[model samples]
Every structure is written in C-alpha cells, then in structure tokens.
Target chain A: MIWLTWRQHRKQALFTLIALAVVAAVMVPTGLAMHHRYERSGLAACLADLGDAQMIRQSEAAVHCQALSHQFQQQYSDLAFVAILFVILPVFVGLFFGAPLVAREVEQGTHRLVWTQSVSRRRWALTKFGLVGGVTVVLAVLYAVGVSWWFGPLVTASSGRMGYLSFDVQGVAPVGYTLFAVALGVFAGTLWRKVLPAMGAALVGFAAVRLTVETLARPRYMSPKTLTFSPQSVLRPNPATGDWVYGQGVRDAAGHLVASGAQIGPCAPPGCGGVAAGSYNWQLYQPGSRFWEFQAIETGIFLALTVLLVALAIRRLRDIA
Target chain B: MTTNDQGAHTMELALETGALGKRYGRAWALRDCSLHLPAGRVAALVGPNGAGKTTLLHLAVGLLRPDAGQVRVFGRDPRDDTSVLAEIGFVAQDTPLYRDFTAVDLIRMGGKLNRRWDAPLARDRLASLGIPPDRPVGRLSGGQRAQVALALALAKRPRLLLLDEPIASLDPLARREFMQALMGAVAESGTTVLLSSHLLADLERACDYLIVLQTARVQLVGAVDDLLAQHRTLVGPRSTDTGTPRGVVSVVRARHTDRQSTLLVRRDDDAVIDPAWIEHDVTLEDLVLAYLAEADTRATRTAWEVTA
Candidate 1:
C-alpha cells in the first residue's frame, strides 16, 4: 500500500521538491549576503545590546542602523514573490496534489478498481492521506525554515515576526496550515467527486478559514496583556520584542474608557476631563514572549481541523458505492 | 462437504443473495434480488440497460452495501468480511485503468496491494498478449486495456471473479478477443465467474448458468440447459377461455392471431401432454427476451392499474 501510494504521488512530490530547491537556491545566497552586511556594519551587536531605547537615544548609531536596515529591506524586497508564494503555497498543494488525489480516481472511474483490492477502503484512504499529508507537512516545514532563515535579520531588526504575514510564513504554523489545506482538499474532492470543482472548493475554504483565524481567532488565543502609561512617559511597547498591539484607548482617573483623541481634563463633567495629564493611554497587546504559545494554539486548531476533515473523508469513502 | 445419494459432493455456492436491495435516492436499483451461483460455473447476468445487473455485481464484490437484506459470497457477508475481499476479483463496467501509469506500473501496484498477487503470471499474460510493459495504459487500445484489467484481476488468484459488463464498450473483434483471454484464465484457474452483459448473444457461448434481471428483480435464475429445457412454446387454437396448463410454472408471454394462439410457458414438471397443443424447445435468447418483455408488460400494467 505504501509503495502504491508513493508511485501514485511521486510526480507531485518530485515537483514540490524541485520548487523548494529553486526557492532555496534564490534565498540562500541573499540570506548570506544580508547576514554579511549586518555583521560588517556592526548593526547586529548594536541592535542586540543597545535595545530600542538606546538605539533611539544615540542618533549616530541609530542613523547607521537605519541605513543598514534600509539596505537589508531593499535587497529583500526583490524576494517579495517568495513571500507571496509562501502565502499561496498551501492552496497550490491543495489544488494540484490533494484535490486530485481522490477526485481523479472517482472521475476516471478507477475508485472501483482500487477499492476492490484486498486492502480495505479505510486502509487505502489512510495510506494515501498519511503518505501525501506527511510529505506536505515536511515540505511546509522546510519552506518555513528557509523563509525564517532568509528573513531572520529583518525580523530581528524590525520585530515583524508577530504580524500576519511573518506569523503565517514562520515557525510551525505553516506546517499546520499545509496539513489543513491538504485535508480540506481531500474532503472537498471526496464530497464533490470532481477535480475542478473540488479544487475551487478547497481554495475558497482554505482562504475563508485562514482569514477567519487570522482576523478573529488568533489575537484572542490568550487574553492580551494591557499596559497603561501617562502621555508624557517614554515607556512604549517595544517593537523590537515583536509584541502585537491590538488596540489603544484613553482612560480617565476614574478608569472610564474614553475614545482616543478625546479631550481630557482633571475636573470636568463625566463626559470630559479637565486635565490631559490625569488621563492615561492603555494598549492591549500580545507580548513577543508568547509567540510560541500562540503558535502552539494556532497549530493545534489547524491540526484538529485536519484530523476532522481526514476522518470525514474516510467516512465518506464507505458510502462511495 | 455433504454428499448426495448419488455419491457426488454437493456443490458449494460461490455467491448467494437473499432479498438484496439497493437504492439511489428514491428509486431502487435492485430490489429483493435473490440468486445463487454454484461454484466453478460461469454465470451470466443478463438484464436491460438499467435492470440492476451492475448493482448486483457490485453488491457481490462488496463495492456496494445492500440497502436491505444481504449479499453473501462463499457463505459470508462480503461487505462485513475483510477476508472475503481476497477471494473475489472484479472488473467494473468501464474497465478503468490509470491512464498515466505504464502497464508494468499497474502490475507493480497490484503486487503491492494484494498479499497473494502473482506477479509472474501477470507479466507472462501481458507478454503473451503482445502488450509492451513500459507503454502507458492510455496509449493502449480498448482491447489491450481490457486485457490488462483482466490480467490484474486474474493474477489475484481469486476464488470468484465478478465482471460487470466487461466487454460492453469494445468492438466485435475486441470483444471476442477479450472474452477469449478471460475464458483462458478462467479455465486455467477454475474460478467461479459472474459476468454481466445486456447483450444476450455474448453469453450464449461463455456462460453455463444464467440469471435474468429486470425491473430491479431477478426474473429468472437457473442452469442454461435446464432453463432452455423447462420453457416450452405451445401453439394451439385461439380461445378466450383457454386455461393455463397444470404443469406450467408461469405463462411468460402470449400471442394471439385471428385463428391460433402461441403461449410461452415455464414447465414445472413433465405431465400428460395436451394432444391439441404443440410444444417446442426455447432458445436461450428467446427465453431471456420473453422474461424481459414480460417484466416490462407487468410494470406497465401496474402503472395503468394504479391510474385506473
């Protein structure tokens, strides 16, 4: 069964490997060059120790770091296609590889051939999903590693890892995304029993789920930490730490939440504050230290979805007759 | 094995269905279709275009579960028993083959999936048929693809081989060639075969046991010789009050001319002959068409009665 699955899917697997190798070919040299430039300009040590405040205080050092960061961003900008590709890679996998897995068999009328073999339908489905889904997860991890390496300097310098784009392309979350996309494709193929429609359904479903998770579910994984500070204070959430600030609001001395940009006075009616200094601005954020925790939660959600879709696909096979 | 009084062992049944039924939405594809095919006999499943032949064959191979009652192969419910799968080989109607795969690739796939796959036999069969191993199945002719499908099933060494309209789409020459290869394999392995086809002429030379299905029901099931021998066409004078003969199982069809009547009847037992009537042996084609025609008349009559 394993051999059969491999034979059936080796073409797609080989294509995926070549695509990854091409990505690596483009990313490796540029990544090394960026690292070299960072080292030569001494921005690595400067950014590592001085932190955001010290860097901001020393204008000369800040200027040099800013110039190096600009150079890094400009050089990396040419590889924007890679980022866009990473974002859509799972959809491609679902369309080309996963959607056609079962749908093609059914469309070509070969399900009857394979389903009648000595192996049961459940084993057949499991072996196909296990081998193909396993390869997809591995490739996605490799891609995540490659992108993380290539963009490591930018992420460190700008504290951009917690944003939507970087978060989707880094760490173990991409692996979960790939698994979920593949499972969705398989489920759609089994349900629709046609290749083109299955591919369309998978793409739409993956996009919907991804958008929902990013917008609605991800920030709420853990209750964000809130911090309040007076307007004159220099204390702000450090971007260098990759903390995600969800929202900010102004609050009066009585702790009533007020709209940002509203007037604040010390002694006034309930709707207004007489003194601006008496009010504080509070920011809701997820700290950079919770990156892994968020990754775990997001990955868990996707993997759970993967399991459910795969199980549904297998159960659907029982009724194929 | 139990023995009869004649000292011959009672034949084991390769497939048996009791009140088996299948439904696609509201309409039944097969209903109360009970049949028995004794082991080692090549049984022909004859039916019209939508007459449940494919459904019955699918049910036997465990590709389909019966909506009601059960289908048993070798005395076990095929849908519930994993062991039963190894004993049955099926070639579905379309003769589906992976168009992207080479002949050898399909054979290798078979070897990987079937525990008892006979790789050498598959290779030898393909070679003898002049099929190149490395050629993709898509490039092969319809006859060649059918041969490859048959070889794959035959190499499984299954005890029962179920073929659902295996030659329906082939040309006359290709059909003959496919059947020839199939019979060669069956003869060598002594496999019990259940082959479905709407073409009655194709079954005349290939099948020993005959099953006729129509209106989602088993219209007739018997040995070919017994079925032909038991059905007689009687010619007699036309009479409105003519009663059915005592020994007749059923009146299959009746045709009336101005002066005479011709009736086809299934005989239950040989009885004293009515001197006025003439009896003639029925051919396999005539018997099958009679049953199919009878089923259609009965269906239309029921529809008319309901409206009236």
Candidate 2:
C-alpha cells in the first residue's frame, strides 16, 4: 500500500521538487545580492552612526554625520521577505499533499476496488490519511525551520518586532495557521469529490479568512500609537490625559477632541478635569503580556480544529460506496 | 453423501439457490430464482433483455445481497463467506479492467489478490491466443481486452467460473476464439463454468446445462440433453384429454388449434398417441421459447384477489 501510494504521487512529488528547486534557486541569488549590499560602505556607515546617536546627543558638537547604507535596506528587505515566504507556504502544501489525496481516488472510482477488498473502509481511510497527514506535518515543520534559518540573521537584528512586519518567527501562529489551512484543503477536497473545484474552494476560503483576520482581527490583537508630552513642574500629570491613539490625525474634522487614543483625566465638569489636558501624541498600548500564552493556546485550538476536519473526512469516506 | 437404494448418477454441485429473491422498491428483479448447477459442468443462463439473468449471476457471485432466501456457491453462503469468492472467478459484463494497466500488470494484480494464481498457464495462454501483454489495456480492442480479462480470471484457477456476457461485444470470429479458449481452459482444468448471455448460439456451442428465466423467474432449469429429450410440442384436434398427459413430465404450454389442441409437454417418449390428435417433436429453441412465452402470458394475467 505504501509503495502504491508513493507510485501514485510520483507526479506530485516531481512537481514539488521542481517548485522547491525554483525557490532555492531564486533565494540563493537574492541572498548573495543581500550579502554583497551589507558588506558595502554606505549601508555599513548607517549602522556605525546608529550607535553614535546617544554619544552625539550629550556632546552638542556638530559631528560628522554618517548615512544609513545599502546594508540596512538589504536587512530590512530580508526581514520583510520571511513573512511573504510563509504566507504562500500553505498554498504549496495544499497543491502537493492535499489536492489529489482523496478526491482523485473518488474521481477515478478506484476506491471501489479498494473498499471491496479485504481491508475495511475505516482502516483504508485511516491508512491513507495517517500516511499523508504525517507527511504534511513533517513537511510543514521543515518549511518552518527553513524560513527561520533563511531569515534568522535579519529577525534577530530587528528583534521579535519583525513579526509585526509579517514574517517573523516570533510565535507559533505561523505553524498553526499553515497546518489548519492544509487540513482544511483536504477536507474541502474530500467533500467536493473533485480536484479543481476543491482547490478553488480552498484558495477562496483561505484568502477570505486571511483578509478578515488581518483587517478586522488585528485591531483587537494590539493597538499601537505614538505620543509626546512634557511633565509638570512638580510631578507627573494625570496619565489619562495621554490616551494612546492608534492612527495618525485621528481627531475629528473641527478638531475639538480626539475620539480615539489613550488618555487620563479627572471626572469633574470644566474644573481640574478639563484643564486643557496638556496635548500630547498618543500611542496605543502594545500587548506586552501573554504573547507565548496566546501562541500556545491558539496553536492547540487550530491543531484541534484540523484534527476534527480530518476525522470528518475519514468518516465520510466510508459511505463512498 | 450417498442416499437410499438408488443408482442415480450424482455429481458434486458447484452452485445452488434456494428460493433466492431480490427486490428494488416495488419491483422484484429476481423472485424465487432457485437453481442448481453440478460441479464440472457448464450452465448457460439465458433470458431476454430486462430479464433477471444478470441479477441472478450477481446474487450467485455475492456481489448483490438477496432480499429474501439464500444463494449458495459450493454449498456455502456467498454473502457471509469470502471463501466462496475465492473459489469463484467472475467476469463482469463489459470487462471492467483498469485502463492504465497493461495485461502483465493486470495479471500481477490478480496474482497478488488471489491465493491460487496460475501465472505460467496465464502467460502461456495469452501467448497462444496471440495477445500482446505489454500494451496498455485501454489501447487494446474490445475483443483483445475480453481475452485479457479472461486470462486474468482464469489465472486464479477458480473452481467455478461465472461470466456475464463474456463475448457480447466481440465479432463472430473473436467470439468463437474466446469460446474456444474458454472451452480449452475448462477441459484442461475441469473448472465448473456458469455464463449468462443473450446470444443463444454462443451458449449452444459452449454450455451443457441450461436455465431459462423470464419476468424475473426461472422458467426451466436442467441438463441440455435431458431438457431437449423430455420436452415436446404435441398438436392435435379438440377431442383430447386436458389433465397431465401420459408419458409426460410436465405440461409446459398448451393451446387449442382449429378443431385441434396443441400441447407442449416435457416427455421423452413419443407425444401422446391419441388417434384424434397429432404430436410433433420440439426443438431446443422452440422448447425455450414456449416456456418464455408461457411465462410472459402468466405474468400479465395472474392478478391478485383482494379479500374484504
């Protein structure tokens, strides 16, 4: 059975190999260009000057200013590239492992022969799913490791903040997301009983969920803002007066008051409460706590959902007769 | 397994159906299709289109479950026993072979699936039949594919071979060749064969036992020679006895001719010699036709009476 499966997937395996080779081929030249730019002079000088900012602030002398170099841009691009790599990982995994796995069998009607053989339908479904599912997980993990390695230098330089930029290996979110999407593709394929339609459904579904999460869910994940304000003569003013607003120029048209932004003020009417609350630039409060906690919890959630969908797929295969 | 005080010739039976029946919704496809085929003999299952020939074959092969009664292959219930399937080689109608596989690949799959595979015999037979094994099955002509399918089934060395229209699509020459190959296989292996076909000529050439079905019922089942010798169509005048006639097995069909009565009876001796009537010998085709015609008439006119 294992040999038969391998033989059946030979074409898919070849396609995956070609795709990976292309990616590796493109990445090598890109990596070389990046290495070259980082070693050049202008970019090198920017890093050298970044540390000198503290030194120059205290001295008050017009020091020789160094420009940010090509190396900095290269590093920035490298950091951004990691996210792009992972966003498309699920698509590749779905194409190779999920698309034809069950749908092809049902479409070809070869499943009837297998179903009527000595093996029970449940065992048959489980064997195929287990074999393919194990391979998919392993491949996903390998891809995650590759993404981490290829962008490790850039990520560490930018700290975990690279995650906010899209492709950072900050938490377990990427792994969970890819596994969920691949399993969802398999479920769709099984339900649809055809290859092209199932692939289309998976693509549309993945895109919709991703867009919704990025646009709608992001605001709830964290609210970031920037604010600048001076301290009082004796002590700090009320913290509520410095509400951290998330976006730029968020004040209403007449500019009477800012509807969004974090601020603190007294509750009285027109007294010390509204003492022209010293104007300040507001930055939304960043979620500093529970990062790993959320990662672990959401990882479990997505993985559990994946297992459930796969179980449904297996159960449905029994009635294919 | 001997019985009382009789020197009757007995043979080991290959297949038996005891009041077998199947129904789909309101219609019955096979009702009380009881039959028996002794081992090492070929049985031809004959019926017109829409008759229960294929349904009976499917029931016998365990591919279909009977709604009532039972079907036994080699004295074992086919539904519950995979052992029965192992002993039977079934060639389904239209030859369902994997298109991507070559003849060699099909035989290899058969070898893996069946416990007893005569690989050498299959290869040699293909060679003798002038069939190329390396070509894909889809590329082969219908006749060639049928031959390949036959080889696959025969390689199993089954005790009983059940075929459904094994040569319906073949040209006359290919059909003859297929029958010749099947006959050679059976003669060499002593395999019991049961085939259902609408083509009477092919059945005439290859089969020894006969079963005729009409309107989802078995009209007649017996040895070919015995059936031919016992059944006769007797035509006479109206002054004839209507009850069971002398030297008669059964009154299969009877009708009143112009001032005469024609009776089709299953009797070996000369048709009843009444000076007032005329008797004639019955051909196998005429004998089978009379039963079919009678069965059709009975089905249409037999109405159920409702009681208050």
- lDDT string for model 1 (B28-73, tens) is 9999987778898998999999999889988998888889989889
Across A112-200, the per-residue lDDT of candidate 1 in tens digits comes to 99888888888888888888887887788887888888777767666468877778888899889888989999999999999999999
Instruction: For each candidate in the order shown, give its overall lDDT on alpha carbons.
Output: 0.83, 0.66
Residues B1-308, candidate 2, lDDT per residue (tens digit)?
12211211366679888899988788999998777788888889888877888888778767577888988888897653656767877787777666777778767766655567788878898888788889878799989888887887788788999888889999999998899989988998899999988867788867888899988999888878777767677776563465766667678887876687778887735445444445676777788888988887777676433221
Regions of candidate 1 where Cα sits further than 4 Å from its true position:
A40-42, A52-81, A249-275, B1-9, B240-242, B303-308
Off by over 4 Å in 2: A6-9, A19-321, B1-12, B19-32, B50-53, B65-67, B77-82, B214-217, B237-277, B291-308
Best by TM-score: 1
The estimated TM-scores of all candidates read 0.91, 0.65
* lDDT of predicted model 2: 0.66
